[model samples]
Target chain A: MAKFKKSALKENDGISAPETTSIAAISKIKEKRRQKKSTSDLVKAILNGNITALSQAITLVESKNSEHLEQANAIIKACLPHANKSVRIGITGVPGVGKSTFIESFGSYLTNIGKKVAVLAVDPSSSITKGSILGDKTRMEDLVKDKNAFIRPSPSGTSLGGVARKTRESIILCEAAGFDTIIIETVGVGQSETAVHSMVDFFLLLKLAGAGDELQGIKRGIIEMADAIAINKADGKNLKQAKLAKVEFNRALHLYPVKTSNWQPKVMTCSAIENEGIEAIYSMILEYKKLTIDNNYFYSKRNQQNKFWLIQTIEEQLKNDFFTNSKIKIELEQQLELIENNKTTPFVAAEYLLGLKT
Target chain B: MAKFKKSALKENDGISAPETTSIAAISKIKEKRRQKKSTSDLVKAILNGNITALSQAITLVESKNSEHLEQANAIIKACLPHANKSVRIGITGVPGVGKSTFIESFGSYLTNIGKKVAVLAVDPSSSITKGSILGDKTRMEDLVKDKNAFIRPSPSGTSLGGVARKTRESIILCEAAGFDTIIIETVGVGQSETAVHSMVDFFLLLKLAGAGDELQGIKRGIIEMADAIAINKADGKNLKQAKLAKVEFNRALHLYPVKTSNWQPKVMTCSAIENEGIEAIYSMILEYKKLTIDNNYFYSKRNQQNKFWLIQTIEEQLKNDFFTNSKIKIELEQQLELIENNKTTPFVAAEYLLGLKT
Candidate 1:
């Protein structure tokens, strides 16, 4: 028995479902529609706070079509001024940590408090399997039905960098469409966490009780990046354990250096299903916002994140250019072979490849 | 009093001397001599275990002259056949953590036990100030005077990437010159650690007693990168506190996720001046080496590191090509300004630059 049930909730809907097109298929359909829509008309609707237009614009951003690139750029530029006003929060947890359950409850809670919430996931692993999105949608039924909340599953069939870029652009579209709070959800297992961390204003980590070797359960750098850690599934029998976990977490957090934000990362316990501690978590986020804003760290961090992603994007493109080069690919293999055989040092080999670019 | 007295040993030497021209200037004079030496002559001398030629070739590697590049590459190519037999070790600690004292003692101990130790420092920060190199050489009196040991200070007036390349190339030259042990040292405060970590077979971090807020002094990912953490200055009155710090470090390390190497990082108390715990630290490294070599992890890890540097080097060169472009440089600033004003997303800005490149 895991501390929190994630996939277990998917099977609890009590009915065998009929065949449905996967999120990947849904993306392809949207991709088809994106080509038919004019960039100006689509951007106009998105800027006018139309959710449908915002969704389509995001689809265009996620599309692989060469024709969609210019259009996606145009829409993002049009929506830029309308974006960045929202509190962009990144949430992550390992499987069985009840991340979906927590988000469903938290998203609904935000909407109830007169906030327009958008829940988007960055699942680069799903890019290969094309799985998790369908599971995510089923677990998020309550929030899916809530009119004030929008739950978009992870975009599939691309690299982490590509998926992250799409999700980041989608945040802009959602913010422009009047969603005041954007929740970027990612599995705690991968590079997606860092991607989400770089784009969001606040990064949240969800953990389970019992102290369960937190180091083993979550990825190495994930804990370090978290702005706050919520010990979820802290209800009834698990409440005491959850409270102990809070103490344990506080100790662990203190071991880390002071974060660049200067705000100490808060650790708290909550039961998403019981709706306990949900308000406290929201209040924590607000408190963080107040502190960072008061210290001018909020805007500075956002700008820093912006600059980070810009450089990251450029580096990604540059890497792709070099690796994707037909000649360089062949040359790289030869250089690696030479390095392995101790015939050439890596630096000299790298120089040869750089020389080849001319 | 601090847990360690690094500069105390220096003061004990009892000599306040006039400022001398730095090691970097000495490198340039050697670089001029390197131009006259034939590549074959240099390689022959290096392969015959001549320290002077090895140093000269390294100076050529560190040289900025375009003429030196061809000769440097040629020398490296000639030496590659004889290199890669040594065990490369990386050591790091904050400024006051007795790094120099520890290294001095450790290097001398290795020489006493019939090991040819090559001590090299990777100080990217030193490149900026053009300091620390002379200080390091002076502090390492015992090791510097040892005929069996070779010590090189950090190369100055270059980017970290450039310095790293020079240092890595120097490792090959040193190994070819029959130095069976290579120690790459770096300040505990910068990007140099990651560079050192990738090139070395083992990474060691030196810490002080009483916990003393390690997180504040060291980078976050660095602790995770350490294969062993030695609490230096564990002597006299500091012994109990050092033991306490050893326990604390172990506990803090256990809070993080497991490493890919499947090796548990060891924490131990050591006294450099007292020459205590030195053998245990060395034994731990040998034990690790034995285990890894037995499991074939040693070779596999080396190959992985080799591939990492190769790819990393290519990426650095690619980024330099794009970023150093006069047009892209100007465009990048404009795009960054737009991103700051929230007039365009980072992805869109990156795309425009990519478009311009094409």
Candidate 2:
């Protein structure tokens, strides 16, 4: 294990460093990168598969620092041709379903098989509290130590769904960086899980054996989107219960129409802690890849996901822009008061507000 | 019982007619009523509290017919001062949890006690299919026929959460109609339940006994927001299991912080089919009302709900405007194609499409 002193780690090249010069240099380079024929440069880096540059470029796109966005656009344009080659997997489960533990074990398995893996954690905790564990690297210490693995925790300070947009952009960067497997792990199954699922190629759901609350899962529709379900902690005393859960889940999954991919949704049991059945899971993924690629469904699915992301991004930005506009603020406040007073119906207030805009 | 054919009903009153002539006549009469604005007229109307007029007003608000919407706004404004007197209760449960049965029994109990009861259903399923068991009068056949009970099924054609907005508007109409107890029944427990919950004074979650889906409920957080939980089908062999489930739910409810209203959530078992425990449910609601009103939390909570609806309405309109614009449509298609070809990243595509507006 390589350990460095906190002071040493705070040096220019270290993780904790302020890196005033490099920060300044990066900004300057970004500005210059903006002025140059950025599209061509972006194209070059993306074709050459530079992951760091791709990630930095994505950050520029997501940044509130408006000045860097244009340059980021150029870089994305350059990288466009090399993107969409890898499998984008979104994994979700309940809070205590051992999501991180499963990812750690699963991710380590992928790395050992000569695959470059990137894990991005998309925590849905509110930005204000800053309470997210972002414990991917901590949980998957072995994978983090491997040269073939790259793990990034949830980027703090954004909406749960908004964090997913950044993660999607980061995936392109990881692919350009030579990672073949990109796994996005969301904290729990909810609206955020749906958001992540919409942006990925394969959606995996992890479950615990004998979840005392089965109806909760059915109501949320988490099981419906799942392409594959793995009942984790399926060892020792839990084995029979895990088998029973697998059967129950299979019955539920049957209710959904066959997915567009035409692949029969699969359910299996695994012990992330015991590192058992990890190889079978990988084999299933490979089978899925071969089946989809043979039918030319892989490229088409990615295309659809990209379009979904495009529209979702536009909708989110437009919402923020309209609500945050200085001009609409007063009228909105007044209308809210009217609504509170029961002097105006919401529909009427909405119409009046929109009329004000025109 | 009063029975009238659709045509006969339409002929009796100008407001019920679908023809332009009757619509014009109703509008003219409404205009005259608006201009007079006599103090006696206002007081008489408030004191009398016509339930039929209130029902018609709510229909006008939910109607897609643009002219009806204007009339609805006028009616709501006139009735505003008389509103806010009702004890608004929102009840939600997973499909087949006997939501309608509970409402039927509960509404009957209230009406029998000299309280006028109005039941409105918010069905998200109406949005996509436009095919709903509208006015599921059959589900509450007895209550529907009761002179003191009013039953309105879901209004068709709107988004999931958006449907609840109309229901909220209808609740105000119901209150003005002199219905002192208004129960808003949601068809399912999902996102729509949250919408119903935010607009009501008290929210009740119904569950089945011995179904063993408790873990599933926790995952979705439906049980968390519940002000009161009732394990239905508590008669017969399931009675013991219902009691056990109530104990488990009570423990789970304790994990949530005391609500802002300072009301301790309660759990009970009921047999809605047998009409047992309905009175107990009513008494619990009354207790909640008295406590919150004395603490000055009741009106304040309603005010917050009104504000939430106002902002939500504006946001929905803005999104609709952006998506429906002819100019945006053309550019959106072009950017989607660019994304499909991998010629642009989704973030860049969004920025470009939005930038085109300027």
Candidate 3:
């Protein structure tokens, strides 16, 4: 992870008067291009897979600069036809589960076999610091240099689910760009994991050899969602424990009814550091894909996930809008204080705040 | 629990009109109520503490019937001024933990001490099967017989968390009605438990001894949220394992950071069947409340819960609105079939659906 000095990318500089005017000019040019370009132009670009335009378009969607949102929507509409061809995989584990390392090894194996890979991180922690170690780009030196590999770090935002509103938009951009495998790396475990799982085609849970406490911390609801569990760091003395965990997870997976796809979930072990068993992990995913496809689960799962994202996105936006209202904000603090002082209950405070907005 | 046949409730036939018209009337009534009723009017009624009105108001809030919602909102607004005086306690356990039996015995103890108690269940099961069980009010026969105590089986026809919402609202109405304590019984051992915990002052997790696989199924997130753990059925040959599980859970709890509240979470043993150690559990909750109040955490926690509920309610409403959109629904089903056929991916389908709406 490349740690950029604060001096390197001054945040305030982007909005300086001269820069602002240039940005305005660029915005005008973008607007003209948007007005003139047919959807076919955009689709062709996406199909020929122009990476820079795709990235720029994704940035536009993520941008708080409202001016860019329209353009972003247009670009996405144009690219939609060529998108949704890839297998979107979501991987999660606790901090020490070696998520990055596993992704690096696993991603490398896929690319080595001529598959184009795109690795994205969903880091909720990035929201506070706005500085993420994984997003630094320099961390995955090998993957970054590979012709078939694409690595994008978490976007800086408040949403814990890695990526952003545009991440889903970007997945289409990636698929359109000819990247057949999109791996979403979420900050290990918690609510954010659920966010990632909801959007992906396949869900992989990475676990350590002895995550007894972790196993307890992860809710059964989440466990039932995983399509496969891979015990990572299964080397040296921990191998036995990893195997044992695999057995335990396998048994736990059985308690759930057969999946809609009619395919049994699988558990495996791998050592990301050693790069051993990575291929087997890939094969397992392939087997799952095959089973799901044959059972007609692949398309249905994707459709459900799509519906989930659309609703999720709208819900998130509505929440943001509700909280951001100036009138609501002014009353919220006072109401919260009232609730704290026992002068009012939460139900009452909420009613009052909502009343103010309406 | 009383299992009144469906035939019995059907006799109240005229009450079964479609909710739209009634909901509209209730909404207007609620608005007029907000404008006219003084806090005293709301409180006076609650201090008289009518259980039927409280139950009806909660029903209004839970029902899709617009008219009832208006009245429910009005009642809640009026009751708001008098709510939150009681200690709200949340209890959850895996299925087969003898939850109903424990509540029956424990509730009887509270009433014996001259404390008016209200027990509400948040049913997580499906709505079709729920009404049958909703009639099973005979489970807590003793508590039901006690004029000072109220036992409400789970409210039927809502989402897993929906039941909790109704339960939380009911707690407010119960408190207004002068109940000294409100015990929320969860749907058991999963996401619903978290929903229950977020709304209460103290959270209790109940468990059975030697429930090996059952214990493993308990989500760690719920365990971490717990303020106390009780090993139910701790009175017989199972005593040894219950004690052992207590040790294990105690150690597990230690791994979590000390809760923000002053009290160190406690682990205890109880036999609901034998009616042993019931009072101790109540005392522990009282002690927790006292400690949190002394440390100034009582009001703060309530404030946080209020904020959480406000945001949660809005989000749920927003999602419901989005999914219920007629255009989105038609497009969604078509896209879902395409996805099932593997002709398109979720990302692409989402983009298409979102595009259609825009």
Error of 1 at B87 (Å): 1.5
| Candidate closer to the true structure by TM-score (higher is better), 1 or 2 | 1
Candidate 3 achieves a global lDDT of 0.75
Q: Estimate each model's TM-score.
A: 0.85, 0.73, 0.75
- Tens digits of per-residue lDDT for model 1, A1-358: 5765656554555676755978788899999866588888987897777788878888888888977877888888888888888999999887888888898889999998899999888888775456664344788888888888887878885588878888888888899889999999988545888889988989999989864655454566777898999999999899998888888788778878888789899999999998889999999999999999999999999899899999998898888888899999999999999888988887778888988987
DockQ for all models, in order?
A: 0.44, 0.34, 0.18
The candidates, ranked best first by lDDT, are 1, 2, 3
Candidate 1 local lDDT, residue B218: 58
Put down candidate 2 lDDT per residue, A181-298, tens digits, no spaces.
9998887634778778877878888888875643343434677778899989999999998998888888767666788888889999999999987888888888998999888887
lDDT of 2 at A102: 88
Error of 3 at A312 (Å): 1.1
How close to the true structure is residue B216 of candidate 2, measured as C-alpha lDDT?
Answer: 48
lDDT of 3 by residue, A114-206 (tens): 999988767767753565546655556678888788777777766653254556767877887899999988875347777777768889988
At residue A122, what lDDT does model 1 achieve? 86
